[model samples]
Every structure is written in structure tokens, then in C-alpha cells.
Target: MTRETVGIAMNGVTGRMGYRQHLLRSILAIRDQGGLALPDGRTVWPEPILVGRNAEKIEALATRHGLDKWTTSLDEALADPSVTVYFDAQVTQARVPAITRAIEAGKHIYTEKPTAETLDDAISLARIADAAGIKHGVVQDKLFLPGLLKLKRLVDSSFFGRILSVRGEFGYWVFEGDWQPAQRPSWNYRAEDGGGIILDMFPHWRYVLDHIIAPVRSVYAEARTDIPTRWDEQGREYKATADDAAYALFELEGGIVASLNSSWTTRVNREELVEFQIDGTHGSAVAGLRNCKAQHRAATPKPVWNPDIPATEDFLAQWQEVPDNAVMDNGFKVQWEMFLAHLVADAPYSHDLWAGARGVQLAELGAQSWREGRKVAVPELDRTGK
Candidate 1:
């Protein structure tokens, strides 16, 4: 019935993910759509103050989007009494100090993950947020995807019967700047600059498996730098020190095993850039970004293996397509909406700083597992540092 504006200081929106997903698809989208509606029939409008390092880029972005409030200094943004929320989509290395300042300023925190490069830093943030009595959230966008939503529904409805295992494939070939300008930033390949496929992706896998399938108990991983050298955006050659690829096996709580491959050097051959196939005793399902397909035990094809004969069965067609029962919003937008509600309406939110710490924990453990050449146990972590 009534509408009110909430000031949100958005930092690091000049980057690709911050610009395309958070600023364009989420925050601005919500503004354009007449704000987010709460359960009590009230509308919560978002007024974003653009904050970044480059003045030209931030100003240009603000002007292009028809926005006015922007500043390069984090202190100036935090000093604004009207700014109640601080959202960070900054580079991984810069997140801690920025978020720490926001927490000290008494602003509710929302950030992109891996919350910090190390588990300790991430946990420290969580503790600090809790002590400050502020609501906080981390981006776990993939859990809200159409396909994953459908998979979650199936899991809830017992569609799979007894779950057995999960196999996931994620990645696409990133061009070297020499021939074609690389799609991703140059910092992604530099370990000193918080770059690596393991640190980048293991956090995502942590939440996905924990929420969708089961809690991750152990991890065994092998990380590699497939392309040791690549050119940067300026066409300057540099040694790629961070891992470009990682092959991993995770042991979940219910004895369910998940094996996943993450790579930036591999070309896409699957239906989507990322896909997860789950097998159970009674049925199996495959889910991509927006679509899912399933095969019941009774309908599964049985073909005898023969070395000499060509296969006649159209195996791909056997699985039935899962329908989109409802309209699905962009994953990033969905999470943004949820976080806003949680902040304003005191709605239950699970993807908090603690959850973010868990993601960082997984990534840290995954790296340790790779280094030690053993299955590393994932101990439970909480806000108390116990």
C-alpha cells in the first residue's frame, strides 16, 4: 500500500558480474519494476549509490543508467547517514577491508562470494557481522536457477527415490588475449591477485551440494594450470600462475558421492555450460541452467555393450523434459529480492555470512586436499569460531 526508498551503496559495479548481474539485472531491474513487494503489502524501493575505483567508469555507468549519487571514496559513501545497506561485488582480494568498513559503519552487508580468499578472514567477517547485530547475505545465485529449482522440487517430492550419486560438468574455453581477447579479466589467472578455478568455483559447489543434495563431508581434488601462459587485455603476455582447471570428488553426508570437473580451458560440448546429473536407485535426472530431463527406472534404456556394433538407440531422446511450472526470474535478481526482504521484513535468510564462511572453508579445504594428495575432512564451522 505504501512505498519507501532504501539507500544501497553498491561498490565495484564496473566489473562484468557486478555490472551485468547486480546493477543491471537485479538492482536497476527492481527499481524499474516499481520496487520489491513485501508480504505486508508494502513496497521497498532501492536507491543505489554507485561506488568504485575509476571515476570515469562509475560516472559513465551512473549517467548511462540515469542515476546521480556516486563516489569513488568508500569513506564518503559510508559516512552518508541515509545509506543503510552496503553491497560489495568487488574483486576477492579487496572484499575483506571494504566489508569490514561497512560492518563498522553499521550498514547491512550483502556481498559476492568467496567472501574472502581464506577461511579465517571469511569467518572473522561473519563473527564481526554477528557482533554488530546486522543482517548480511552472500550471493548464492545458482540455487535459484530454473533447473535447480526443479531439481530441488523433485528432491522434495521424492522423485529420485534413494539418491545415489551426482556428477557435474562445468566450464567453457576462455580465449587467450593473443588471438582473441580473453572473455574474463586477467586477474583471474594470477594467484597473487586472488585468481584460480578452485577458489572461484569450489565455494559454488559447496552451497549447491549442501542445499540440493547433501552436506559436503570430505573433498579430494587435483588442481592444474592447463595453459601456463596467456596474454592480457592489453595484449601483454604473462605467466598464468593460478590453476585453470580442477577435478574433484566430494563425499556428502548421506554417503552420496559427487564428482565434478571445473575448467576454463575446455570447450563446451554439453547442453549448457554447466550441468549436473544425479543418479538414484529408482530414477535419474540431468539439470542444466534452465532445463532439466529425467528418466524413471522403468523407462531407462538397457543396451548391451558390444565393441563391434554401432548403437541404434537414440539414448538422448529417452529422457523426458521437465516442465517449467512457473515463471523463473534471473538467479541473481531472485537472491537480491530475497536479501532485501530478509533485511527489511525480517524474513528468514539462510545464505548469511556464516554460510559464506562455509564456502570459503570448502575452497580452502579443496586446495589443501590437492596439495596434500589426500581426502581432506570438512569440519563444521560456526560463528563462534568453534
Candidate 2:
């Protein structure tokens, strides 16, 4: 069997999402599993060189994982011809400059969402990468989730014939830094840091809705800083300048409407931290992070509208749990494997830097809708104002 090694310059490996999900869980896990197998009896192995601003921390992290390489200089890492790919998991604001340098260095690029804090910057990066003729990708892990995968299957199978509407509930009560420490980083609440619920999550929603449900053509949203004040990691009191919650309405291509509530201040009263209920004429399904439940029109029960009498119907038992017919892998890891396969085998991969820019576009429109208190049209990304 033939094996090929591709060096990956993993930038911002020190950040929480970078370290935990992208680094340890996805990349390392792929390397541990004997590399990604190709269709032609070959295997592709990723040689990740951890890149960050702090040498000691990355070195310690490398040592803890028993890896050989770690570096503080991104320029040096990019300068290495061996490093064929540059993966960015840095803060939103840092993406443009870093990715610009990497693209100029002739490296394939993959990165976390919002590609940039604004639509213009995101489109600029996408255009630059396109002009440079480099392969590019954006992280859209939610599409690969088990629940969403099952939901997609249901959609594909026509189980939900002529889908009508979708309701999405995504959020959990993040502890305030006073009595209990905030679970999320303090930078998440500060607007100056390119941190806001809309910027952070609307990207995910855009991709998910476009891929799974339907193409989003318009959006009307309301954003708020639900929590006025919070404490930082160092027990420092700070004002939250960014929006913590977003109530959104979206219109899809097939006349499907979607309602979404994203917040860090609300309590989770559902199956998972994130869930979506899709309703249609023939059937309906509710999908959580890892599980999905469905109820068809044939299985619909008859009930009287008698709330005066005690509630007797077992509403929870009405929906049947969808079983996993195939083994499910970590969402992030799955995407990484696909990306590596694309790099080595020249496989068909559609989720690219332009897709990432669309995410940023949706977010900007969502914010605009909130500001103007009106629905905003989502035009196709034509950098030229045609």
C-alpha cells in the first residue's frame, strides 16, 4: 500500500476550538486511525506542525500529545514548502492577514467560520484565494452531525414531502462570571474582539439551512445583549458590547420558512443544546445534536382540544426515535478526513472559501435586518455589483 505525507500548518492551535476540536479530536484522531484510506488502496497521512504565538504552550501541548513539532513563527511555518496546507482556527479578526500570507505562499487553506468579521473581508479572502488558484475550505461541521445527517436522509427520502417550515432552538444558559464562572470565553461577549452571537453562529445556520433545508433567500432578525454585564477569566468585570441572543426568521427557496433562536442566556429545555423541528405535509422530524425523532401524518393521533381536562395523551411517545443505520464519526474529524482525501485524491469537494464568505454574508445581513427592523434579501455572492 502506498502512503503519502502532507504537512499541515495548524495555526491558532492554542485557542479552545483550535486545540480541542480541530487539533486533538480531528487531526490527531485522523493520524491515530492509520491515516485516511483512499479508493485506490493508498493512504494519506497528515503531518501537522502546531503553529501559535506562544512556543512554550504549544511545545507543552505537543509533548502532551507526544508530537515532534511546534513553532511560534507562522511565517517560518508558511515558508516551509513541505507544509502544503494552512488551517486557521484563529479569532475572526486575525483571519484575513494570516490567510492572505498563507495563500500567497501557495498553500491550501481551511478555516473556522465568519471567515472574517465582515462580509467584505470574507469575500476579499475568497477572491484572493480564487485568484491564487489554491484549494480552499471552510469549517461547516454541523452538516456532518449525526442528527442532521439523519434529518438530511429524511429530507432526501421524501419522508417530509414538500417541507413546510422549520423551527430551530439553539442555546444554553451560560453561567454568569459572578456566582459561577462563565463556561464560554469572555471574548465571546466583547464586540471589539469580533465576538457576537450573530457573527459566531449565524454562519453555521446559513450553511446548515442552505445544505439541509433549503437555500436561504432572505432573513429578518432581532439581536440583543441579553446579559448586560459579566466577569472575565481574571475575575474582571466587563460590559458585553455584542449581542448575546438572536431571534431570526428566514425564507427559503421552496417557500419554506424557518424560525431560529440563538442565545447564550437561555436555558436548554430540549433534548440537546441545539435542536431543529422540521414540519411538512407528510411527516415531521425533530433533530438534536446526535439523535432524531420523527412523526408521520399516518401515525398522527386524534385528540380533543380539551385543556380543561387533565392532559392524558403521551405526547413524548408519539415521535419515534430514528436509529443510526451506520456508524457515526466525530463531525469535525469526518470533515478533516474528507478534506485530506480531496487534497490527495483530487476528490469532489464543494464547501470552499466562497461558501465561507456566504456564511459571513448571511451574518452581515442578519445584523442589518436587526438594525433596520426589516427583512434583508440575500443575493448571490457576485463580488461585482451587477
Best candidate, TM-score: 1
Candidate 2: regions farther than 4 A off? 382-386
Give the C-alpha lDDT of model 2.
0.92
Worst 10 residues of 1 by lDDT: 377-386
Q: Which regions of candidate 1 are displaced past 4 Å?
A: none
lDDT of 2 by residue, 1-386 (tens): 99989899999888899999999999899889998899998999899999998888999999998988789999999998889999999888788999999999999998988799988788888888888988888999999999999999999999998899999999999887998999998989999999999999999999999999899999999999989999999999999999999999999998999999999989888879999999999999999989999999999888889979998999989999999999999999999988888888889898888888889999999999999999999998764411
Q: Deviation in angstroms for 331 in model 2? A: 0.7
Clashing pairs in 2: none
C-alpha TM-scores of all predictions: 0.99, 0.98
Work out candidate 2's RMSD over C-alphas. Answer: 1.2
TM-score of 2: 0.98
CA lDDT scores, all candidates in order: 0.95, 0.92
